[model samples]
Target: MSRLTDLIARTKGNDPQLGADLEREFKALSSRLPYGLNFERHSPEAVELPLRPVRKGDKVRVLPERGSTKKGDQRLWQVKAIQKAKKLADLELLGPAKTETQSVALDDLVVVAEFRDTIYPGLVSTGKVERGGDKPFHTVINGENYHALKALTYAYRGKVDAIYIDPPYNSGAKDWKYNNDYVESDDLYRHSKWLAMMERRLLLAKDLLNPAESVLIVTIDEKEYLRLGLLLEQLFSYATIQMVSSQINPKGVSRGGSFRRSDEYLYFVMFGTARPCRMPLSSEWSTSTQSDLENSSEDGSPVTPDWTSMMRRGSEAYRNDRPSMFYPIYADPITRKISAVGAALPNGEHAAPPKKGLVAILPIRKDGSEGRWQIGASELESRIKQGRVRLGRSTSYGFVVNYLPDGAYADVISEKFLIQGYADDGSVIAFSEAGDLSRVASTQWKIASHNASENGSSLLATLLPKRKFPFPKSLYAVEDALRFFVLEKKDAVVLDFFSGSGTTAHAVMRLNRQDQGKRRCISITNNEVAADEQKALREQFLRPGDADWEKYGICDFITKPRVKAAITGKTPEGGSIKGDYKFTDEFPIADGFEENAEFFTLTYEAKSAVNHNLAYARIAPLLWLRAGAQGLRIDKLPPEGWALVNTYGLLTEVDAAAPFINAVRQAKALRVAYIVTDDDRRFQAIAQQLPRAVEPVRLYESYLTNFSFSNGE
Candidate 1:
């Protein structure tokens, strides 16, 4: 037992909750080692939330009721006294004139919190930027993500479609509080803190995800990939786990005598019904003429232009096999032009003969048994309009019809084809232009084998030319990872707690632009400066919360601005960025996304006030996220005691239930409604009257219910 540990240990015994990693650090730091400038955030700058109640001498800052403050209420003040009855606190200025005092609502004040303290989280809108249109607002929250995740559980529990996190690799690099060089060992002392941190956040993250169908993507380097896998297994025991070794760092880092570390691990914890979607690979041999997979006829005959028999060949060719597909194709024998198609008959029933003037073409086999067409009646009609289905040759009854097999028939049924336009016959001319359908993503993703070896630094420089990070993920790499999951989920709710530099958000925007999807990304990061920078700031007598100090924090300095530049298509100086995105989809950088975004700072609120509806303003954004981050939000209490929007509604007063119910009936696309009341009977009565589609959530009770649970995290 080191003397340093003994000194910090509780009077009777050591604090059981205190991490053993901290104990090791206490010993080493006290052993007198030389400190380095390689540092990280000034934690105090992001938050000075000492987990204690406000007292007469505690220095604090006042808060704005609406929107985020630019310079924040930086003037220092002391908690003069508490008026419990009025629910107000008096704050005295901490300057030379100590007598000046003012009273403010206790709810507006944030006193910070500890584990024991139940925090009612609040959102302060910093600002917003829009590229236009009615896109759901992608959010970037600047706060300690641990508390922020807890807050999100109330809004997004059981609703998130995917969560992709690039957590700290826990390489034990020298930082603000460090006194040594980067340590590569994965010993208990180094790994314990990171594992514990991830365990806590992942557990909370579980509540946010849709257990029925969601994916948890975590990227880690060799430093903690093994530990992360074990921890993920421990936490998500029921999930289908798989690790993808992506060669993100193709040019491996030569760390002393060991092999150069290049590849990193991506662990995908897939929940129920969640699976990787197959992607298309542009065929090397495929030309515009060979877009169709086949070239010759089954009878060893030469090709006839771009047409193939409508009769399904090979296996499953019998009418009984696909009874509904054995329908008739109506064609004009004289003109050899298809007029219309007949409907599919029930099993054991025959298709009704075509009208008198039209000749019916049946899938009759040479062996004299009935066969089925390649597609159904409706599919044939659609293909006929595309000019894909046309007359092939004269048959006994009419001109035998054929359809253009431009691509794999199976792919046409299961994949999203890129439609070029309609042909003269109203046919949907399309192409399968990307990944090869038959190619599967291999477990060992070597850099030499894949095109995803994008330099993280070089890629970030394209979006943010002036800023940099210790490890910024390649934008294209994130976009590729997201495409596998969100490609099919147009409205997926993707979350990234460790959203350093807001790379995930930028990636989502690019994904949405490619497919025109509604996937909303929620990014959370702290506004903390680098350790060496913090040291420099302190030397100038600048402290946390100071404008200059806060400016360099990650959220203010990088994440928010990066996302803004992506959305507005301009640099901080309001000039077009000098480049185009050619990595995946080639587009000019100045051509910003047609998306909307809002910035927020997750702040502490009084739990009591939340239960009594006194903190509704602060909690509105949380509810908006829960209802799906689309359309307008219920950011303020409605004057009519209730509010209705495209996605959600709120009923503040049950007396106004009639109006609220009428509004609910009128809303064409309301998914969730919140009732602000204390009485369980009142809540149920109101809930029963609401439409079946509207999920009636008890606003105040919902807040407390989310807080009611506890776990070791």
Candidate 2:
């Protein structure tokens, strides 16, 4: 053995695993050798020629050796005609090289084939699950970009149920990489890539949705909202579109020019739902609490407690178009009950008592106070019981109290009472206004009078932290959009390719926590700006200077920051963050290959020998299975009415009259043996003479390459 082989063998003898890897590399090198031309073997004495495969139709790239300076130059050849060796002189390109060339073997020429292109971007291949320590829940491959997204199209090919995309808006700040290129503001294809990228993802996304369930909602902004809409129309046959203006926050963007645009609009488009054009009631629901009301305490009133301001605001809102249910609320102090609840009538009209039982509160004494005011629940119950309440005469339900007012009137009067100033000690603020207490009536709230004190920011604050993550969407916003479709015990899969700071993930987490629903979110992000890296850096600051990064979040950082906040109750929105989150970083398998299976050796046998026959059985017939082919037809059968079969053809039977049949029928004589004959009746008749004899017959021809039967007679 060579010194190198000896050293490798010695090293492998010590480290078996490394030795196996080295051996694999060595074997791979042999299989990757360059292929070559074909040659005809007319005679063993004749020399071979270097020639290509003369197929009926073959298109190949040609490389010409034009530069003469090179000593060992090989000319580049392109596609030539399909001709025999004798007709080579007819081809123009073959004329120059024929004089100096000799016949060559067929294996000496490289063969080429036509190129095939695909729309898929990444490599998608099935692989076995590897179980060990520090592994993810499961390994899914070829999920990168177009490849991953397109793979989903196969299962949902040609149709889909719904398409929801939260792609990066290309704000010029966040990292949104497209095709190995960062989408910076300077690049012209920034919008094109964004569109194209979205276009491809959307095509696949669109196919996944069912025709009946074909509804797509894109949460995008001024950047590419119109473009996205156009793309949608082009991709989908039926497109009914609408844009909903959602007041996400009362605050506006400060451009230092004119005004800030605080609120954003969501483009809602539907293709095949029962209701299109009109915004359908979302399966998603929003949760409202005292936290949602601005400037008001948990008691639900304006901070300042100005009765006049409340009255003015109430009167204004009363005149404007508002939900009939939100009309004015008037109460009498005496019974401490609501007298009338509705919008004010026009032309200074006094609303008639629609119900006889309906009664407003009357001050017991001269002034309404803590002791003198109270409403009777039974009185209101009596009104309903007595049929005092009147239904609306027309479609518009005017102010009509069904029963006597039941609840106590709020302390502060007037709409302005919503505003409150700081006290000297900042302990208790005064409710300065007590405008009027004549009649409690239904009223509409005016848009202009809508103040901050009437708004709630708690729920909104939770999803959108204070600079925690920029442009973080409000959890309540997501809830409002998703609540309808969500249900208990239902497992839903939510995917967002444009996952930023994982708002969608957070929203899903919050939803699951509240409803105990089984919803999993598959968020895809390119980490363009290195969001994960930035998070790591921030985490480093939070840790001790000397803490090892690999081990830092191992236990402490087991959860993502968002997940940590979710579980630890450290959310921006006050309230408990719910449920435990398991974080797993998915990684691709290292680039290489591994052995799929191992083969074992077997001993030689008579049956093995028979299988190796060309006229009978082919040698190494077992190789046919490895060659990915199956089944064989045998034309002949064994003749043994009473015969002795050895191990090769075991003959273990004994019979006085029919020995061959007895031997053939012996169980000990045939482990890997069977029989056949051209004449069944003759074989059977002879077999009857033997105690335990059998017969064999022919089937078809052999297909095995190595099959042959050679015996010295």
Winning model by TM-score: 1
lDDT of 2 by residue, 1-713 (tens): 36656766887998765675565455545444253311121111110111223332222223112222221213323323433554331112222435433322222232332111122111212222121121111111212334344434432343433334566777664456553335687875567667656665676566555556445667776667777666666666476676655555456666558667555556655656422211112111112222223223455433332111111122323323322222233443334344554442333333423445543321112132111112233433344343222221111222222211222123322342332543331212334244211221111111211121222233223422442334555544554344333432234444555544444544555555455554444444322224344345444442112234322321122113343343334543444543222212111111111111111111122333333332232222222211111122122233332233232121222223344443444545332222233344544454454333222322111211112211101
Against the reference, the lDDT scores of all candidates come to: 0.72, 0.35
Instruction: After the best TM-score superposition of candidate 1, give how far the Cα of residue 281 lies from its true spot, in angstroms.
Output: 2.6
Model 1 poorest 10 in a row by lDDT: 37-46
Candidate 2's C-alpha runs over 4 A off are 1-143, 155-163, 186-189, 256-258, 274-469, 487-489, 531-713
Maximum-lDDT candidate: 1
TM-score of each: 0.66, 0.35
- By summed lDDT, which 10 consecutive residues of candidate 2 come out lowest? 41-50
What's the C-alpha lDDT at position 376 in model 1?
83
After the best TM-score superposition of candidate 1, give how far the Cα of residue 218 lies from its true spot, in angstroms. 0.9
